[model samples]
Target: MEWLLTPGPVQLHPKALEALSRPQLHHRTEPARALFLEARSLLKRAFGTEGEVLVLTGSGTLAMEALAQNLFAPGERVLVPVYGKFSERFYEIALAAGLRAERLDLPYGRVPRPEDVAQRGFQGLLLVHSETSTGALVDLPALARAFKEANPEGLVGADMVTSLLVREVALEAYGVDAAVSGSQKGLMCPPGLGFVALSPRALERLKPRGYYLDLARELKAQREGESAWTPAINLVGAVKAVLEAVMPHLEAHLALKAWQNALLYQVGEALGLRPVPEVKSPAVAAFYLPEGVPYGAVKEAFARRNAVIAGGQGPLKGRIFRLSLMGAYDRYEALGVAALFREALADILPAS
Candidate 1:
């Protein structure tokens, strides 16, 4: 495939792919335990947190749900700023977990300001640092600082699935209590594993609401180099491989953001496509599809070239389309993809 540019399950790095296909190991064994421990340590660096990073055997949503259920008690007022689909998912998870979710709903492409959120005042704040559906990246450090100033005891949780490796998420420096991420997007691995990086305060607040997704139980076991249940052994191996490659030379990994933004902006400008969100995310870019251009035509055009791009989700679906610059894409590959993006656009747009 020339591209696997949908929001998640992106093309994995060769090392991660090799690790994913390696012979399965028993989770109780010594080697498996060592792998778990190594991956957890690397993940802490990825999240930029001195606290615990819990590896879960599910998708990113599972981590988000875990944070919702664990970080706050029932009936605690949690402020959720809903701007796009993923942010809305955070709010939904909070409500489902029996928290008093106070939503500050904004239009799909609008980025929520920190002051506005702090003004609302709640016991906890659940936010999507990068909203993939609309390609909006929030100012997380500012938001976290503001929230901490207003409600010092309040916990702040972030969905960093799209922002994890693409952007520098300094959880400790930013004062984020908890953050959730997945393997597929910035980790350059296949889907399966979810991670929750928690501050010491967040760890203390953890009250397990369920058995399978219980953070408290997982934390106890993980600290001892084990999993609470049968783990995704292959996926864990893949994560360790990717992190080993990334953590040593971290600056290059973080540079993916700037490279992606440049590619997306150049493509959008050359093709006359308007970006959906005012503040774009380097992880993904969404644009309003040209008038009279159905998403089907766009998909088919890209498919012809063995390239894949994503369409918008929720209310923006059919009206907009998305492109991703995640995975282990370097400058040369980005240039090639940008060229292919132009060709794909040429194939779809009517003859001028």
Candidate 2:
């Protein structure tokens, strides 16, 4: 109802909404199997990979957890490049999954060059291709190459949830071992499906781990057109509808990114709210507030104007607010949000 702006729950298409209302099919039904298989096939194009695409019913983070569980065993050393909050997650997931994670820390606004991975020789690497918190997009391909050079036999997992379709990433071409993404963002679907794709090398590297989040078992079941368990039938249908109808226009998506970010940059310049210089992402814009204005005031200003946006996360909380343009954001809609942003920012700036 309100001008939908935050990243995850984007404006759903009427068709997708209708798909949710379709009769729930048994997970093993012939029709469900057909749609399920179709969605998996579509994901390969979505991720630019010919490898198996695993569609599991969970949040995007679950895809990361699945990789952590199956790919690395306890005490195996992994490298995590931490610059933003989401990147820090790799370290946490690694620790939780029993892998010993070493980190290459960079300043909040800075990005590590892709070749930086070649300098480290950890057994595996958990890389956040897109730093959601800081709106910094990392160089995934370079990192992938460097990882191979440094640890040819080790694994490399990418969290592509925010960057998957916003830009061009060839998962299979880049030789990345595994990657995770979600139904939300570029896919423009509801938030119930977590998608993963793995290279043959990644599968070979996977060791025995947890059961439910197991990618191997899920892949086998998915290939047969059924989930290993009761799936999110309606949500999967939504994914099918959106991917079939919306996600193919890569050029349009790139233009959408450009349009939204151009407006954001204009508004930011007017208000003197600047994104961190070096590594801004196409998916979202992260900007610091005007001097002396609290984070709550900016949020309140948008609320009063019939709009809402995202706040900062972790240590960056209270310092930056994120405007996500990942899903279903149109030029006109973004312009309207920019208008509201200008007014809100004007009110928050110091009376000089």
Best by lDDT: 1
Clashes of each: 0, 0
How does model 1 score by TM-score?
A: 0.97
lDDT of 2 by residue, 30-123 (tens): 9999999988887888788777788888988888899888888899889888888877887898899988888889877678786767855577
Overall local distance difference test of candidate 2: 0.79
Task: List the RMSD of every prediction in angstroms.
Answer: 1.3, 1.7
For model 2, the stretches where C-alpha displacement exceeds 4 angstroms are: 350-352
TM for candidate 2 is 0.95
Which lDDT tens digits does candidate 1 get at residues 217-256? Answer: 9999999889898889889899999989888888876776
Per-model TM values vs. the true structure: 0.97, 0.95
- Lowest lDDT 10-mer window, candidate 1? 253-262
